[model samples]
Target: MNQPVSAVAGIGPRNEEVLATMGIYTVGDLLTYFPFRYENHEIQPLSEAEHQQRVTVQGTIHSMPELKFFKGKKSRLTIRILADGLLVKVVFFNQPYMKKQLILNDTVIISGTFDRHRLQITGAIVKPVEKIERGGLEPVYSIKGDLKQHQFRRFVEQVTDGFIHDIEEVLPESLMSRYQLMERKQAVYYLHFPKDEQAFNQARRRMAYEELLLFQLKMQWFRKNERQAGDGQSKSWDAEAVNAFIKRLPFELTTAQEQVLSDILSDLSSIERMNRLLQGDVGSGKTVVAAIAFYANFLAGFQGALMVPTEILAEQHAASLRELFAELKVNIAHLSGSSKVKEKREVLEMLASGEVDLIIGTHALIQEGVNFSNLGLVITDEQHRFGVAQRRTLKQKGLRPDVLFMTATPIPRTLAISAFGDMDVSTIDQLPAGRKPIKTHWGKRNMLQRVLAFVDKEIEKGHQVYVITPLIEESEALEVQNAIELHRTLTEALPHRRCGLMHGRLQHQEKEQAMADFQSNAIQLLVSTTVVEVGVNVPNATVMVIYDADRFGLAQLHQLRGRVGRGADQSHCILLADPKTEVGKERMSIMTETTDGFELSQRDLEMRGPGEFFGVRQSGMPKFKVADLLEDYRILETARNDAAKIIQSGALFEHDSYRSLLMMLESDIAFQEEKVD
Candidate 1:
C-alpha cells in the first residue's frame, strides 16, 4: 500500500506501461492481481508421472516428426520425444504444421495430456525451451493483448520475491487466527507464486475473505449515510391516505405488493434516512408499490420525484400515475427531453414554487435549472442504468428525501444481499391473481412463416404483438435481425395488418409516436429492439416473438417475455433461435422451461457466473479483484458475519488492523463523494 509499482525490481519501462494498463500502478495492486486459474505440472521423471494426467515434460525429439492423413487432411500427426531417458510419444490432431516447426533431436518443452500406460502425450502445447515457465504448479493470469503469459508470470514472481513485505495487514489478528486464514503478506506470496497446492488453496481463501469484508464494510456504511443530511426526520405515513389510494385502484393489490408497501412506509417513517431497493419480476407491480411510496411521501407534506432511464418510460410513468392518482387530486408534473418549451417552463415554475406535488421524468429532471421546493421521495426505475452522480444530483434538490430504486431484473438472492446490502431490499415475488403464466416455445428461424401466421392470428383476436430483434439495422458484422429490414419484411408478409418500427436510434418524437400507435391499436404489430423491454406497457399485446433469442441472457429474455401476459388473456412467448454453441442452446432451453423469474435468475448465475451476471463493473457495485460472488459465496457469508461482529464491537475505526481497513476503503469513499460533488 505504501510503495509504487516502480519500486518492484526488474520492472523496466515497457513492462511498467503494460502493467499500468491492467490497473497495476502500485505494489498493492500488482500484489493483488491474483492468478485466475492454476496448472499442476511437477517436474518429475516421465516414468514416475501418473497416467491420464497433464504433465509438462521437457525433452529432445528422438525421431523425425511425421505428418500423414489416411482420412484426407483431417488425420493426426505423431511425433516421438525423449524425456528423462524415456520415449514420450506425442500426437497432434490435424495440425500438420507441427512437423515443420520441430525436427529430430530438437530440445523442447511440451505440456500435454499423458497416457502413462503407453508413455504418450496428446493435445500438448509445444513451446521452445526458453519460453516455458518451468515449475511444479504454474499460475495462469488473465491475459491482455501483447502480454505473454509466461513473461507476466515471471514479472509477478520477481516482484513478490522482492517486495511482498510491503503488503500491510488489514484484518485483525483475532479474526485472522480465529478463521485460520493465511497471514496478509503470506497470502500475496502464495497467491502469485504458490509454494504448493496447500499454500495455493490457503491464499485463495484468505484473499476471497478480504474482498467480501471490504464490500460488507462499504455497504454497511452506505446503509446509514449515502445521502446523509442534517435533517433525518420525515413525517409518518398516513394510513388513511394509503388505504384510500389502494381502494381507488380497480384491481386489488397482490400480497407481495402490500408487504413491500409496508416495508417502504417503515423506511419513510424512520428517524434515519431511507435507502431501499424494490426488486420484482416483470409485471410484478413494483410501480404501484413505488407509486404509493410517492403518494405517502406527498401526504407527509413533501414533493416526490421519479427518474426513469428512457424518455418513453418517463412518459408512460407520467400517464399511468395521472390516472392512478386522479382521485388523490395531487398536482403531477412531467419533464423529459422532448417536453415543449412552454410546458417545460411551466413545470419548472410549479416545481420551484411548491405547486407540484409529484413529478415524473427522465435524467432531465436532475438538471440544475429544475429546482424542487420540497422533494421528499426519489424513486429511480432501472437502478443500474443511472450512475451515482445523477442520483446524488437529484438528492441535492431536497432535504435528504427517501431514496427508492426499483429493478424488474430479479437478482439472485445471494447477489441481492451482497451487492445491494446497503439498501434494504423488498421483493414483490408474487404476481396478481388470474394473471396467466405465459406459454413459451422455441423454434428455428427457418420457421419464420409459421411465426408470421401466428402474429396475424393474435391480431385477429383484438391483441397486438411485439417482434424484438437485437440491432437497429442489418450490420455488416453481425448476422442477427435488425429493426429496419425486419420491419420491412413483416409489413410485406402481414400486408393486412399495420406494422410499426422502434429503436433507440430513432428520433425521440418518432419513438414516442410509434409507441403511442402500438398502444392505441393503430399498429397491430410492433417490430422493435430491446428498447421496449422495460416500461412500454401495452396490456393488449399478448404475443412476443424474440428473434435470435440465443443472443440474449436469461434475465433479459425474461424481461422481453414480460412485455406480454399483462392482460387477462393468455399470452405466448416464442423464441426463434439458431444457437451457435452449447451455451447458447442451454440459455434458450432455460427460457422455454419456466416463467419464474427468480428461478431463471439463479440458473443464469450458474450459466454466466458472477462476472457476466449483472455485469461486474456496470451494476454500480464495487468491483471484486479476487472473490466471485457465485463461486465464493461461502467465503462471503463468513466475511459478512465477521463484519457484523466488528460493527457491533464498534472497533471499525480503532486499532491498527481497522486503521488499514479504513485506509483501504478511502478510494470507495472518495468515489461516492465525487458523485455528490
Candidate 2:
C-alpha cells in the first residue's frame, strides 16, 4: 500500500500524473479511490430495453457504420443494429475506430443511454462478444484528467490484485465483531471487485462506519482533553452594567439572541476558557452579541481581537464594532495584510501599547509583529472560513482567551455536534425584524434568455442583479458554468448596462473594486462564484441568477440566496439548472419550495452529504474518504456514542486495544492536524 502508484503495473510517469489529478498518488490512494457509481453490463434484448435508461443491448450489425464529420462539428460514427427482430440506431462521437470493430453481421454489445430521439443509443461502449473479458457490475470511479472509466477500473484492479493484504486491520476485533463488519482486507477487496450487489453494500458499510468512527473518536478525544486543561480566565461581571449596555443598542435583541448572550456571558465568567460557536442565519443580530462579549472582556481590563476571513469583512466588522462600543469610549483599530505600511505599523504599535481597547483584522492580526498587551477575547467572523491551524495560532496571542466563533452558514444540529465537537455551540435561530423572504424559482438553462430579459427589466427599475457561475473559468476536465464567460455573455446581451466580474482567481484589489462598484450601483450586473457566498451585502441587488445551480449543495445554494433579500424590496433567487439526475432535480425543487436555511441544511446533509454539503470548493473542513454524514447517519450516531464513552473512560488512544486506530487517525490528513492542549 505504501508503493507509489507508478510502481503498479501499466502505470508510467504520465499515467501517474493522470491518476495524481484524481487524488491517487500512492498505491494506497488507488486502493481507497472508491467508485461513485456502477453500471451493470448484463445485456438485454432491444425489445426489453427501457427508453432513456442506461441499458446494454446486444444485436447483429444491421447496416454499415458510416464515418461522417460536419464542417464545424465533431466526427461521428453512426450505425444500425438488429436486436430481437427490432432495429436500433447507435452513434459514437469522434470514435471512427468503432467502425472497424463493428462490421456487417457482426454481433456487438453496446452499453449507454438509450436515446429515444431516433430510437438510438448515443456515446456507447462497444464490445464484441469474443472481446468481452470482464462482465457484470463495472465500477465508474470519480475520475479526472484523461483517464477513462475502464482504464481507472483496470488500475484499481491491478493495485488491488497483489497488494490488498497490505491494508492492515485498524479496528479492534471486538468492535468489528460487535458491528458484524468485514475485515479491512476483505472489505477493500470486495469494494473494488464486488461479488454481487449485497456484498458490495456490506463492504461499503464497513468502510463508511470505520471512517466515521475513527473521526468521531479523534474529535471526541480532543473535546474532553481541551475542556479539562482549556485556557480561559475567570471573570467577575457587573450584571447591571451589562444590561445597561444592551439597553443602549440601536435595536432590541431577539429572544434567541438574548438567550445566546446569556449563555456566552456565563461562559465568560466560568473558570474554563470559552470556545463556542454562534450560529445564525444571515441578517441575524450576531454582531451585537459579539460586541457585548467584547465589552465584558474590556470592562475586565482585557483587550479584544476579532479576526475575519476577508479584508473587506474585517473593515466592515471594525466599523460596526467601533459604533457599538462608541458610548463606552473603547478604542478600536483595524489591521489587515492589505493595509498600507503606515496604517499597519500604527495599528501594531497601538496594539502593543494597549492603547487599542479592541482590534479587528484579518490574518494580519496573527502575524509575528502584531502583539497584544493582554489579548483576553478572540472572536472569528465566519469561523469555518479560517483553517484550524490558523485559528489555533490566534489562541497563542492570549492565555486561553474567551473564544467566540460567528458563522452565517446554518448547519443542522447533528453536523454541528460532530464537526465542532471540540467547542460548545449557541444558535440564534431567529432573524431580525423586517427580513423579507426571498422568492425562489427554478428553470433549465434553456430559459437563459428569459432570465437575461428579467435582469434587463430589473436593471431598468434601477435594481442590480447578481449572476453566479460555479467555476471561475473553463476547465477541460469539468463542464460547469464559468464566471468569466458568463460575464462576457451578459455584457454583450445587455449592451448598455455596466457589467462586472468577480471570482477567487482575481487579485484582492480587483475583487474589492468589483464589489465596491456593484455596491455603489455603478455595475448593473456582477457575475461571480461562491466567493460572494458570504460577506458581501448589497441590499440594492434584488435578483440573483445562479447558473448550474444543480451543481451546488443545498446549504451553499441557500447561502447564495441569502445574498439577495437583504433589502426590504421584493427579492428573487432564480436557479437555472437542467439537472439530468433525480437528486439534482430534487435539490432544485426544494430550493423553490422554501427559503428556510436550516431546513435546507438538514435536507442538504441528507441529500448531498457532509463533505459535499460543506462543498468541494470550501476550505478548512474535514474530509472523509468513506463516511457520509447523510447516508450513514445511523452508523455515525452509533460511532459518536461509542466515541463519547471511549473518551469519558479516557482509554481511546492510550489503551493498547486502540493503538492502531489512533495511529491511523494521526496519519490521516483528512482530519486536520490536532494540536494537543
Candidate 3:
C-alpha cells in the first residue's frame, strides 16, 4: 500500500506528477483519497425527471449525432434520444468525438441536468448501455489539473483490486466486534466501489471511526506523556489569605468564576503540571481570576508570567493587576517591545533577581534575554494569537512550569475536545454583575444617515463609538467600506469630533498610540479593521458600528459586539450590512437574537464545517480523511472514551492487540513531531 504511484499499471510518469500535485504520492494516499460526494446512476424514466434536476436516464438514439465546430477549437455535438415515449435533445460540448460512438437506434445512458421546458438534457457523461454500471452509485472525486474523474477512478480501482489486502488494520479485533465494524481492508475496498448503499454507509462509518479513534489515542498518549514529564511544584498558599484577597476586590466573583478558580487552584496544588485552557466571552472577569492565581503563586514564593498578544493589552493587564494586588504588596513588573533598552534591562534584572513577583508583557517575555527566578506559572492571553512554538518557548523558560491559556473566544465543546483534548478546559460562562446585554440591529445602506446621527448623539453623551470595516484600504473586488475611507468619511461627517484610524498595516507604536488615544477619550470615534476584535477594553465605548458585517463569521461578529456592553450602562451594536445570501442574512439575525458566544460558536460550526470554523491553519486540528468534527461528533465522543479507557488500562504498549495501532501512531509524521516538540 505504500508503493509509489509509478508502481500502478495505468499511472505513468506524467500521471504520477499529476497525482503528486494532488498530494497522492503513494498507493495508500490514493486509496484514502475518498470522494467528496457520489452520484446515483440508477436508470430512471424521462417522465420522472424534474426541470433543472440531475437525473440518469437510459434512451435509444433517435437521430444521428451532428457534430459542428465553432470559435476555433470549440465544438458541440447534439443528438436526439427517445426514452419513456418522450424525445429529448441531448447536447455535449467539447466532445465532438461522441458523434462516432453515439450510434442511431442504440441504447445509451445519459446523466446530467434535465431541462423540461426545452425538452433537452445537457449531458455531462454518457456511456453505452453495456458499459453503464446500472443501479449503482458513481463516485465523484475532486480532481486537479489534467486529471479526469474516470482516469482517477480507474487508477483507484487498479490499486484497490491489487493491493487491498496490504492495508493493515489499526483497530483491534475486539473493537471491531464491539462496534460491529467491517474489516479495514474490506472497508477501504467498499469505500472505493460499494455494491450498495448499506455497504457504503458501513464503509464510511468504519473509516470515520478508525480516524477519530486514532486521533484520540494520539491525544491521550500525548497527555499521558505530558503528565509524566516531570514533577510539578506543589505550591502551597493560605486559603484564608486568598479568600481575604478575593473579598478585597472591588467587584464580587461570579459563581462560574469561583468554580473555574477552584479548578485552577486544584491543578496548582497537584504534583502533575497544570496545562489548562481558560476560555470565556469578552468581559467575563478572566483577568481578575488570573490576578488571583498570581497572588496565590506569589504567596508560595513563586513568580508568575502573563503574556499577551499586544503591547496595549499587556499594559492594560499590568495596570489592572497592579490595582488588584496593591493591598497584598506583591511586586509586579511590565515589559514590552516598545520598552527602552535601560528599562528592559532593569526589568530583566529584577525578574532574574527574584524581585518581581509577577511580570506581564507581550512577545518580549519569550525573548532570549528574558529569564525568570523560579517561574511557577505562565499565562498567555488570547492564546490563539500566539503560535505553538512561542507558547512552548515561554513554558521552557522554567522547569516545567504550569501553563494556563486564556482566550476570549468561546469555543464549542466539539471544537474544544478535538483541538485541546490534551488539556483540561475551564470555561467562565457567566458575566460579571450589572453587565447589560448589547442591543444589536441590522442596518441597510440607506440607513447610514440615521446611524451617523445616532453616533453623533452618543458622542454628545460623552460616549465613544467604534466604526469597523472589513478592509484597511479600498478593495477593487469587495464593495465594502475600508478603514481609511471610512475614517475620512466619518471625520468629514462629524467635523467637531476627533476620529482615529487603526489597522494592521500600522506600526506597533502607531497602533499603540491609536489605542491609547481612544482609551483616553481623546478620539471620540475610532475607525478600524478587525484588529480591535481582541482584548481592548474601554468602558466609555458604548456604540459599535460594523459595516459589511456579513463579511465576518458569527464568532467574530460576536467578539466585535463584545467590545461594547463592557460597562454597566446599556450599549448598542449596529450591524450595517445587506447580505445577499440566506446564510449571511441568518448570521445577522442570529447576532441580533443572542449575545451568548458559545451558542453563536456552535451555530457557526454548524454553518461552516470545522476546517473553516477556526481556520485550518490556526486551529491546530488534524485533517481527517473520513471523520467530520461536527457531523460525526457522537462518534468522536465514543472514540475519546474508548481511547481513555485503553490508556487508563496501562497496557497499550504491552498488549499485542494494540501493536498495530502503536505502529500506525509511530508512523504519523505530525504525531511524531509533536512528541519531539
Cα lDDT computed for each candidate against the true fold = 0.84, 0.83, 0.89
List the candidates' TM-scores in order: 0.91, 0.76, 0.95
**Against the true structure, candidate 3 has what lDDT?**
0.89
RMSD of each: 3.5, 6.4, 2.2
lDDT of 2 by residue, 356-474 (tens): 99998898888888788998889998887776768888988987788888888888877886678677889999987787889999988989999998989999999999999999889
Question: How far in Å is the alpha carbon of 259 misplaced in model 1?
Answer: 1.0
Candidate 3: C-alpha RMSD after superposition:
2.2
lDDT of 2: 0.83
- Rank the candidate models, highest lDDT first: 3, 1, 2
Q: Give the poorly placed runs of model 1, Cα more than 4 Å off.
A: 43-53, 57-61, 64-79, 82-86, 91-109, 115-119, 125-135, 143-145, 226-231, 667-677
Q: How many steric clashes does model 3 contain?
A: 0
Q: For residues 1-677, what per-residue lDDT tens digits would candidate 3 score against the true structure? A: 78898988989989998889889999999999988888888788778788899988888999988889999889889999998889989999999878888888999889889999998988658878776552468888888989898899888888887888898888888999999999998898878777789999999999999999888888888778668734688889898999999998888999999999999998888888999999999889899999889888889889999999887788888888888877777998999988999999999999999999999999999999899999999999988778777888999999889889999889999989888888899999999999998999999967989999999999999999999999999989989889998898888999999999999989988998999999999999999999888878899999999999999999899989989998878899999999999999999999999999889999998999887876776567778888898889999999999988898787677899989988887897767754322
Q: Score residue 616 of candidate 1 by CA lDDT.
A: 56
Native-to-model Cα distance after best TM-score fit, residue 327 in candidate 1, in Å: 2.3
What TM value does model 3 have?
A: 0.95
**Lowest summed lDDT over 10 consecutive residues: which window, candidate 3?**
668-677
